[model samples]
Target chain A: MRLERRASVPPILYVAAPLAAVMVALAISGALIALAGASVPEAYRRMAIGAFGSRLAITETLTRATPLILTGLAAAVAFRARLWNIGAEGQFYIAALATAALGGAASAGGLLPGPLLIPFLMICGAAVGAMLLLAPLALRLRFGVDEVVVTLLLNFVVLLFVSMMIDGPLRDRMAFGWPQSVRVSPEAALPKLWQGTRLHVGLLVAVAMSVVVWIIQSRTAFGLEAKAAGFNPRAAAFAGVPIPKVLVGVACLSGGLAGLAGAIEVMGVKGYVTTDLSPGFGYAGIVVAMLAALNPIGVVAASLFVAATFVGVDGMSRALKVPSFIADVTVALSLLCVLVALTLVTYRIRR
Target chain B: MSETLDILASASLWAAVLRIATPLLFGVLGALLCERSGVLNLGIEGIMTFGAMIAWLTVFKTGDLWFGLAAALACGALFGLLHGGLTVVLGLSQHVAGLGVTLLGSSLSYYLYRLAIPVSGSPPTITPFQPLKIPLLSDIPLLGEALFSQTAPTYLAILLTLAVAYALAKTPLGLAIRLVGENPHAAEAQGLDPIRLRIGVVAFGSALMALGGAFLTTAAFNSFFPTMVQGRGWVCIALVVFASWMPLRALGGALLFAFFDAFQLRLQHVTGKAAPYQLFLMIPYLMSIAALVVFARRAKVPQALMQPYRRGER
Candidate 1:
C-alpha cells in the first residue's frame, strides 16, 4: 500500500473527517466502558442527558466551556503559526493570579470605579500572560532553544511559583489556612449573564473573542504572514516577511488569549485564584485547538463538546461507578483519531 | 552556610542522590535512544505514568516484583508501538501525536487503576526493592555506602548507561541508527529500511523508559499515585538536549540533576520556614531551562529529528 497526497481536498472533508473521528473515538471508549462491566449504550445515554438534559445541566456545561473557548483560541492561534505554546497552563495561572491581585486591590482601594475595574484587571492579566510566553519565545529566537521543552518545563515552574504565592503572600487569611488568593471585591465580580445560574458574561466575552480571532487569522495581513511563516519559513523569509515579528505577534496573541481565559475564570466563576483554578484547561485547550483543526471559530464548538464530555462524564461516573478519567481518555483518543482523519482527508491510500 | 556543607557531607544524602538519579538515568537513556532514531517520544510522561501504575499493580496482585517490571516493559513497548504508528508510520506531527499519546497513556492508567482498586483513603503498597549491598564494596567509608548500597535496578541503570554509550559509539547497528537519524536517504542507499529501524528503536527505547517508571513504583516508592511521574519525563527530554544526544553525558546530566534535587530537599529541611519549600521544589525545572539556554546553541541535533521520512519523497 502507498499513501498519495491528494491534489485537492474537498472542503466538506474537513468537517466530515472530525465528525468521523469523534464517532470512532466514542466507539473505542464504549468498548472500554463495556470492559468495565457497564452497558455502553446506557452509559452514553446517561452522558448525553447529564450534559444537556436540563437547563441547569446545559448552563453548567456552558459555564465550563467559557474558559475552554478562550484557552482553545489560545492554542488555536499559536498552533496555526506553529509556535507550539504548550505552557498555556502556566500562562493561565499567572494571568489568573495577576487578575486576582489587581481585582483585590481595585475592590479594596477603589482604585478604579466599579464599571471600569473588570476591563482594567483583564487587560493587566493578558499583559502578564503575554510577557510570560514572550520570555520563552525570546529564548527560542535568540538561542535556537526548542520552545516546546521550555514551555512545558515552565508549566511546572509556574505552578510551584503560584503555590508559593498563594501559600505565602496571596494567602487568604479568612479561609482557615487554605492556600488560595483573597476573593475579588464584590464590585469587581463579573455580573451573571442569567439570573439563578452559574453562567456569567464571560461566555459572551469568550464567544466574542473567538470571532475576533477568526477575523484576525482569516482577514488580516499579519494572519497571511503568519500562515506563510508557518507553512514555510524559508519561503516566507524570501518573500521579505519578518519571521521574528510574526512569531512575536503570534506569541502575544496566543499567550494573551490564555491569560484572558484565566482572568475570565477568576471574575466570572470563582472570584479568586487557586492552583487548581484550571482543571487542565490549558492542556485541554491544545486538544480542543487540534480537534478544531486550529480554526478560531471551530474552537468554540470543540470546547463545548469537550466541556459536555467532562460534565457528562462526571455524572456518569457517579451513577455507573466508571472512573471519570474516561472523559480524559475519550478526549485524548479523539485527538489521535482526528490527526489520522485529517491525514486521510489530505491523502489517499492506494493498494 | 556550614549547615549546607554538613548536609552535603552526609553519606545518606549522597545515597539519596544516587536513588533519585536512577529513574532519571533510565529515562534519559530511553529518550536519547528514541531521539537518536529521529523520533521525539513526547509521550514519555504518560508512558512513564502507565509504567508506574502497571508495575505497582502487577506486584500488588501477583506478588512478583520482576514480573511486575516485565509487565511494565511490555506495556511500555505497546504504547511505543502506538506512538510509532502515529509519528513514524502515518507521518503525523510528532509534537501533537506524542501529546495525544501522553494524554491517552496517563488517563488510561488512571482509569484502569480506579477500576482495579476502589476509592480509598490511601493507595495500596507493595514490597519495594531493598538496597542490595555489595559485600566488600559496600564496606568502604563514604563512596561505598553512597554508590554500592543501591537497589538492583539502580545497579542495572548504571550498567545500562555504559552499555548504551558503548553500543551507540561502536556497534554497526548503532551506526545504522545514527545514519538513519542523520540522513535516512543515506541509510536507504545503504539498503537499510529506515521505518523499521525507527519503530524498533522507539519500541526498545520506550521499554527502557517503562523500566524507569517501574523503578519509581517498585524501588523509589512502594505505591502508585496519579501525577507521581510529575513532569520527570519532560525533565528527561531536557536532559537529552543537555547531553547533546550522547549517552555518557546523559548519565552525567541525570546525576547532576539528581544531586541538585537531593541537595535541595536537604536544604529545605535545613532552612525550614526561612524560605518556602516550594522554592526548593522549583530548582530542578529552573535549572533545566538554564541548562538549555547554555547548551542548546552548541548541541548538535539529529538532522532528521521531527522530520517525516517518506520512502521516495525528496
Candidate 2:
C-alpha cells in the first residue's frame, strides 16, 4: 500500500532508468523543437551531426566537453561526500583569475621558461580554488553556516572581481578596446591534441584526471570515509570517521577540479580571460554529476553528452534559425526527469 | 562636499531605496513563509522570473495590469505546486528539486519570453505601474513621500508583511504551521496533516514571490529583459536568513539591503571612473554575506527545515 525501498534493485534498472529518462526528456524537448519551427527528427539529426558527425565536429564537442568533465568531476567528488559545493562557479572564476594573473605577470617578467609556465599557472589556479573553498568549509564546520548560500553568493563576488580585473587591472592594452585580459604567452597555452582543430591537450588532462578520480573514489581509504560520511555523518562519526576532515578534503578537491577546468579553458581555447568565459559550466556540472550518479568514470561520459547537447543546439540554431536556448530548456527538463527516474531506481510502489 | 550632502539628503534617493525594497520585501516574505514551514524553496529566483514574464506577457496582451498581476499569482501557484509535489509528495531531495525548479523556471521563462517577444533592435516596452501619491501623507516630508508615494503592490507588500507577522504570532493556523515546521511528528500525533500544511504555505508563499517578480516588470522597470531578476531572488534568500524568518525583521532587512543597493547606484554617478563601480556593486552582496556570517549562527531555523516528512518514519 506504500512505497518502500528495494532491498536489492535489479541491475537492469540502473541502465534502463537513465535511458528512459533521457527518452522522456527527448520526447518532450522534441515537441519543443517542433514548436521552434524545425522538424524534430531533422533537428535531432543536425544536432547529432554537429556533435559527432565529423572529426572537426567531434573535436569541437570534446573541446566543449573538456571543462564539463572537470567541473562534473568537481561536483561528483564533493556531492559524493555529501558536500553541496555550489560554489564551483565561484571557484572557477577565482582560479581563472589567478591563472590569468600569474600568466600575465610571468609574461611581463619574462623570467619563467615558457615550457614551465603552463604547469606553474595550472598549479597556482588549482591552489587558489582549494584555498577559496577552505574558508567556506571552515565556516560550515565550525559555525554551521550554510555552504549553499555562502558558495552561491561567492559566485557574484568572484564574477564581479573578474569583471573588474578584465576591465581595469588586466585590460589587454594591445587589443583594440575589448573587455578582455591579455592573452597568455604561447608557451603557456595548452598544446593542441590534433592539428587543425580547437581540441587541445586539456582533453587528455581531463581524461587523466578522470582516471585519477576513479581510482581515488574506488580504491582509496579516504573515499571510503567520504562515502560513509556522506551517507550518515553521525553514524560515520560514531564509526570513527573524521567527518570534518573528510568534508574539508572533499571540498578542496572539488574546488580544485573546477579551478582546473577554468585554467584549461583559458589555456586551451581563449588564451585570455573574458567576462563570458564560462557559460554556466560550473552549474552544468551539477547536472552532469547527478546524471552520472556521482560515479567518477561516469562523469567523463556524462560530460561528453552534455557538451554535445550544448554544441549541437548551437549548430541547430545556426542551421534551423531556432534559438539555441532550446538546449537550456532540454538540459533543465532532463535534470528533473533524471531525478524522477533516479527516485524510481531505489524505491518502488508496494501493494 | 555640500553637493554630496545634497544628493544623500534627497527625498528621491529615499524613494529609490523604498522602490528597490518592494520586490525584495515581497520575495523575502515569500521565502520566510516557506522556510518557516520547513521547506527551503530555492526555486524563489525561478518562480519570480516565471511570474515576471507571465505578468509582463499578460499585461502586454490585455493591457490590464490587474489581470497581469493575477496571472503572475497563478503562475507562482503552479510552480509552488510543482515544487511541493517534488519535495513533499514525491519525497525527493529538496535541494535538487529546488535547483531543478530554478533551472526549469528560468529557461522556460526565457524561452517563452523569446517566443512572446521576437528579437528586435530594442526590446519591447509596456506601460508600467505609475506611482500613486497619497494626498496628505506624501506631502509631509522626505520620509512621508518615500513611504506613501508608491505603487499599489508596494503598499500591499508592507501590509502583507505586517499581516504575516500578526498571523504567525496570533492565529491557530499559524500555530499549526509553526508546530509542523518545528516538529511534524507532534503535529501528526495531534491529527494535523503536515503535507497539506506544507503545500499550502509553499503555494501561498510562491504567489507572493510571483508578485515580487511581477513588480519588477510592472512597477519597477515596465520592460522585461533576459536575466532581469538579476539575483534579487537570491538576495531574498539571504535576507530570510538575515531576518531570522521574522516578517517584520524581513522588512527592515529588505530596506537595509535596498539602501545599500540604492546608494551604490548614486555612488556610481559620483565616483564614476574614479572608483570601480563593480567593487561598489559588490558591497551589497558582501554585506549580505557578512550579515549571514554574524546572524545565521544564532538564527532560529525551523527544527524540521529541509527534512521531508514521511508518515510513520520516526
Query: Tens digits of per-residue lDDT for model 1 on A1-351?
Result: 657899999999999999999999999999999978998999999999999999989999999999999989999898888899999999999999988888887778887887888898888889899999999999999998899999999999999998898898888888875689988898878899888999999999999999999899889999999999899999999999999999999999999999999999999999888888999999999999999999988999999999999999999989999999999999999999999999999888877
Residues B285-307 of candidate 1 have per-residue lDDT tens digits of 99999999999999999999999
Tell me, by TM-score, which candidate is best: 1
Docking tier of model 2: it is medium
Task: Compose the digit string of candidate 2's lDDT tens values, residues A144-247.
Answer: 87878788888888999999988888888888866888777877888898999999999999989999988888899998999998888999999999899999
lDDT, model 1: 0.93
Q: List the residue pairs that clash in candidate 2.
A: none
Docking band of candidate 1:
high
TM-score for each predicted model, relative to the true structure = 0.99, 0.97
Model 1: DockQ score: 0.90
Model 1: fraction of the reference interface contacts it also forms? 0.90
State the fnat of model 2.
Answer: 0.51
Best by DockQ: 1
State residue A60's C-alpha deviation in candidate 1, in Å.
0.6
